[model samples]
Target chain A: MKKRDIILVAAVLILAGGIWLITRVFFNDSGGQLRITVDNEIYGTYDLKQDQEIQIGTTNTCEIKGGKVTMIQADCPDHICMHSAAIDKDGGTIVCMPNRVFLEIVGQEDGGVDTIAQ
Target chain B: MKNKIAFLGLFAALAIILGYVESLLPVFIGIPGIKLGLTNLVIVFILYLYSWKEALLISVVRILAIGFLFGNLYSILFSLAGGVLSLFVMYFMRKIPGFSVLGVSVAGGVTHNIGQLFVAAFVVTNFKLMYYLPVLLVSGVVTGLLIGMVSGEIWKHVGAYIRKNNREKL
Candidate 1:
């Protein structure tokens, strides 16, 4: 590897590290709302504080209890959705690839970040 | 012309086979979207031994064929985004005088992840997915390094043969 090669690799690693540090420092989860989508369309948004079971188009079922959401049941073959850990934090995401379903926790404070970044 | 077309077909097929073999192995990492990117070996090899056009053609054809055969529609979209972005980055990086094949591959790997994440964000409509960027960056470097090293070795032996055959045909 040449000097420029080293420099380029270093630059990427440093940039990645910087992003990670920024996110970690600002990371805050205060019982955010859970947003779910299916096939790239909005399915529903549920309050994390509320306890309810969501049946997502017969493909998967998500249960929210004690301010945490988890995929309790899914018809997808891999069951990777069900295996994902419960999410209650500001940016935690659970995705069901087979069904094209996605779930993530969005805090009120960070809502503007998405729009601004876009 | 015939030799170039045959070489393209052979490389495309090799890429598809590598992709299929990778899919067969169960992912031990819990993180989604992480893979060995074994098919990239073929892409890197082509980029060094041939032109970017040939490499790009092989990458696109392999992704489309493999996606239809072994993956879903969503997968096709993701792979298209990642593969094209990676190829673009590698192509330009190879032009830089000081960049080695390893550097080009690492850049490709990193951009590939960024491209896939962009698609994920768009599909999920969630920008918070950026949180996964750091992990992906590290994985991209590690996997890219390995793939580049392997590709370099393969190119050392096979590259001359391909070039010689093309010249002979001409």
Candidate 2:
């Protein structure tokens, strides 16, 4: 309602500043890939855009393709992992919560976990 | 007592209508289940025009009915926690001199989001969800402003109605 109130609103917006620095330091998601392998193969690689697909067959055999790893055809019912896009940055994860699987990419810059693959 | 019950029923219906209308305005952001909380206007007005008990009752009924009607049972935990926390915050804030219904409403809006975010972190099993906190807070500020404005307007109208009715009675 007042000129000062306008300044206060602007100050709040500018100062909010994401509070993201705390997250970066606390999580320690700095440089380097969190390499992942399943069933004796390079099943998933993080922190890059390789976009590979990995297929697991019969719960015993795992195949890698497309530069990333995927459950391909998992025995799980949700198939939520299949819906995830490819991740290539820090905080990115390929999580199969039902199948007891987790793959994370920790890029130093990106805070978003984009893809949870099959 | 009968009059109070009738007034509460009317507030319940008003809350339901506002909740339904607010649901139609979606955030373009991909996050799910976040809302602007337009129904808060009724609760804010109740705190000043009625009593804390009545305001709290309205909050609970509003959230429960909205949750059930939308089949958002999975999100009920967040809604319940947020609704209670927001009401508590506003109830305490109402004690301040000149705080007015608008100030109480703003405080409630902010606290609601705070409570919901706390639940979200636990559900996802990852604290990374905290990154969205700032966004949520900013949204809270905007929605708070809107709710505050609406509550202020409603209070003015209600005050005018009471004055007019009193004059007629005399």
Candidate 3:
């Protein structure tokens, strides 16, 4: 094996491991989602009902109906979120990576206002 | 050249299909642009089958076709960066005379992801996005290994056939 082989393997392993670890930290449910940012905006006590619509980030749009929020449209290049269906239940999350928006349903953890940005 | 082009076209089709199929597969991990990269097998196959230029062409065709068909416009740049980086690594590995294409593939995949990450870090106005690089790299390793192993087996079959056919012609 060339020294390049060793270097490449080590580099990939270390970086991938770190990203995986951070993903776990961000996505893993603990107590509840402390913050929810849709397009980097901090909305307070986001109340939702059936058929309520909201735009996520700049590209994607979302709606809530029957106490569930679903992505309606995404101008994002991938439209992965637009392809992703709605979330009507608790503990559901939506991510638009290109738009850099993350939407989450924070359950009755503290049951009050909280800072929703990292 | 026509026969060679025909063979290349076939491989390109295979790579495109693999790329699309992989998109539908559930994320082994949740990070975007991070996946098993099942199609790199085609790249590895090309690396073994012909010259570096041929392999590089396959990589370009496959990445562009899949990106245009299934992904957004920005994907083009990222794919280009990754493909170029991968071929560079593969070219070096090929210099070792009898270097295993599988090993070359592993290097390619990892370096491709690295290239993508580097571009993301530099291109994006917000530097915080670099945070995602760690995960993309990790996924690259596993996927690279998978493509490597499969391509290694495939190379055996393709190599034997090519040798046999060439000898008959000679």
Candidate 4:
């Protein structure tokens, strides 16, 4: 309603827009690998180019098909994980909170920097 | 003194009931950590109608009660971070002249999401979680605007009633 209020809203909108642009441009690496972790431990990494099914500790199941990873099923009551969309780009994630399972996409370039410096 | 305590208790209960109602709604948005934050309506109402100290007390007590009733340790941690951070921001913003309730609530909503994101990043040690900022920020603004408008209306009636009662007592 006031000048200050308009400034605050505009600032927030611009910040959000900037973050959206950065994520879209720099973070969306399509050739990313799917990294699955269960109970805070690394379960395994699978190539997004391959099709496979992963079962995590009898609590959740994930499927990688056609270059996308999805939580196919879960034992959690809400099934929020199962409802989450498939992830095929870097920085995307599917989390099963009740099961303590986390799946994320990591671009191949993510670790390349460390390997190159070494 | 007794009346003050009674009103605080009433506000806390109202906040908790609003939280319960929000939890019952199906996730219209599939994204996690996105909610209408209906309970904040009460907190914002208290901020305008009473002192910041009272608003802070009600907010903390409501989050703790909700955590005990329906959440685990993890939920408690995130809610504590979000609720405390937002309350501080809202209180500070309210002190600045020329800022409307809408602006204060908008700041509160956005910061609440940011605070939760910080906790999530710390828990997972993944900074990439920042990628969710855009969605969360937009949702925050929308929900904050809605809550702020509702609270503005409630404040009109409640503020008048409280002023009348205090004047009568004197």
Candidate 5:
């Protein structure tokens, strides 16, 4: 490979690694609640500690078990949300773009309200 | 002139076919934007063979065709964002010295994902979508390298053949 090509590849790797480090250090935390949103509006917040299934607007079904939330079922054609990895303590997201459903792990210290800036 | 136009059409068709092939594959790592970016092979090749104008045209045509045939309106918007941004990046990268098709293609692939992420964030009205940056960047680089390698191989033989044909015609 050319010198510039190697540099280009190395640059991308380093940038990706840096972003990952930042996210792990700053964003990811042992969250207590899973925030579900539809079309940017709050749908509901479920506790990760409790095991339960939630149906969001008849388009998606989410399950919370063992401190992890997963899109157990979806009617979307791609089923991308269904295939996405479960979001847990380390703070991740599952977005079903087709259905406009978004599930995220947020550290809600105050169970009364979502004060987290997100 | 006719030959060049015909080749551009062929390239667009090939890109669409690659897009279809990619659709057949299951989503990788469960990430929305992560894919083989197989169609980029044609885009990179055409960029080197012709100019950004032709490359842009082919890219647009392929995205529109594939988007309508297999995807929905939302998908079309996302694809347009990614495709146009990547094409611009590749066009500029090609002008830099010592950076070959591999480098240009890598730039294209990574920027493509970034562009899509921006649109996704805007659509969802949440910047938290940036959370996927790390994974998307890594996937882009990996797929870009693979596509670039194949493109380089194709350019070696096809580029030479095309140049020879042009000289004979002249």
Candidate 6:
């Protein structure tokens, strides 16, 4: 690798680290809600603080407890959504592309940085 | 010209096979966008051996073929977005001073994930998809570097062969 190649790799690594750090430090569950959407329409929103199981149209199910949400069940062939990490204080997402269902953690006010694009 | 066309077709087929191979493996890290991106090896090789246009053509054909055979329409859209953006980035990076194959491939890999997230966010109408940004970025860099290294080595060999052929033709 040349000088520029190292520089490029270093830059990307630093950027990734920075984003991870920022999300870990700033993303919290204070008034956060788990918003589930199906086919671009709102399915339901659940309080992150609540300990309950969400069955999303028989395609998938998720559980929220102690301010963390996990996809406990999914009918998708890959089961990737269920394998995804829980959305805790750091904020995360679970998507079942085959079923066209997705879940995300959004702050009541901030809604994360991607919302600014709107 | 015929030789180049034949090479391009071969590379495209190779890319599709790589995609199929990738699908056979389970998802890495259980994240949606994180994968070995093995086909990127073919893409990086083409970008170095041929040009951006040929790379773009091969990538599109490979993505479409892979999607139709192994994935759904949604995956095809995601591949299109990622493939095009990565190719575009690699094309420009190649022209910049001091940037080598590794740098170009790295840029391609990183931008590929960003482009995929952009489409996912749009399709779901939710920017919260950005949550995967950090993981995807790290994965991109790692996979890009691996693909870049392999392609760089291949180019060292195949590049000489192609140059000799060109000299003979001229």
Interface RMSD (Å) of candidate 4: 8.5
Candidate 3 lDDT, tens digit per residue, A51-103? 45776445667776666666678777887766676654345677878877677
lDDT of 3 by residue, B22-93 (tens): 878875565456767677787777766677788888888888898889775557677788888988888887
> Candidate 6 at residue A97, lDDT?
93
In model 3, which regions exceed 4 Å deviation?
Answer: A1-118, B97-99, B167-170
Model 5, B42-133: lDDT tens per residue?
Answer: 99988888889998999999999998998877678888999999999999999988998889888999999999889877876767667789
Greater-lDDT candidate between 2 and 3? 3
Q: Write the per-residue lDDT of candidate 2 for residues B114-155, one digit (tens) a residue.
A: 788888667666665677676666676677777888878878
Task: Please write out the lDDT profile of model 1 over residues B1-170, one tens digit for every residue.
Answer: 78777878888999999999998977627556788899999999988877788888998899899989988777788888999999999999988788888899899999999898899778778777888899889888888888888887888778876777677662
lDDT of 2 at B21: 89
lDDT of 1 at B3: 75
* Regions of model 4 farther than 4 Å from truth: A30-118, B167-170
Ranking by lDDT: 5, 1, 6, 4, 3, 2
Q: How big is the positional error of residue B122 in model 6, measured in Å on the Cα after superposition?
A: 0.8
lDDT of 6 at B57: 93
Give per-residue lDDT, candidate 6, residue A103. 91
TM-score of each: 0.70, 0.66, 0.59, 0.71, 0.71, 0.70
> Candidate 2 docking: what grade?
incorrect
**List-wise, what DockQ does each model earn?**
0.27, 0.13, 0.20, 0.29, 0.33, 0.34
What's the best-to-worst order under DockQ?
Answer: 6, 5, 4, 1, 3, 2
iRMSD for each candidate structure, in the order shown = 5.7, 6.3, 7.1, 8.5, 5.6, 5.3
The 10-residue segment of model 6 chain B with minimum total lDDT is: B161-170
Q: Where does candidate 1 clash, by residue pair?
A: none
lDDT of 3 at A109: 27
In model 6, what is the error at residue A20, expressed in angstroms?
A: 1.9
All candidates: CA RMSD (Å) = 11.8, 8.9, 13.6, 12.1, 12.1, 11.7
Candidate 1 vs candidate 4: which has greater lDDT?
Answer: 1
Off by over 4 Å in 6: A30-118, B168-170
True contacts reproduced, candidate 1: 0.60
* TM-score of only chain B in every candidate structure: 0.95, 0.87, 0.87, 0.95, 0.95, 0.94
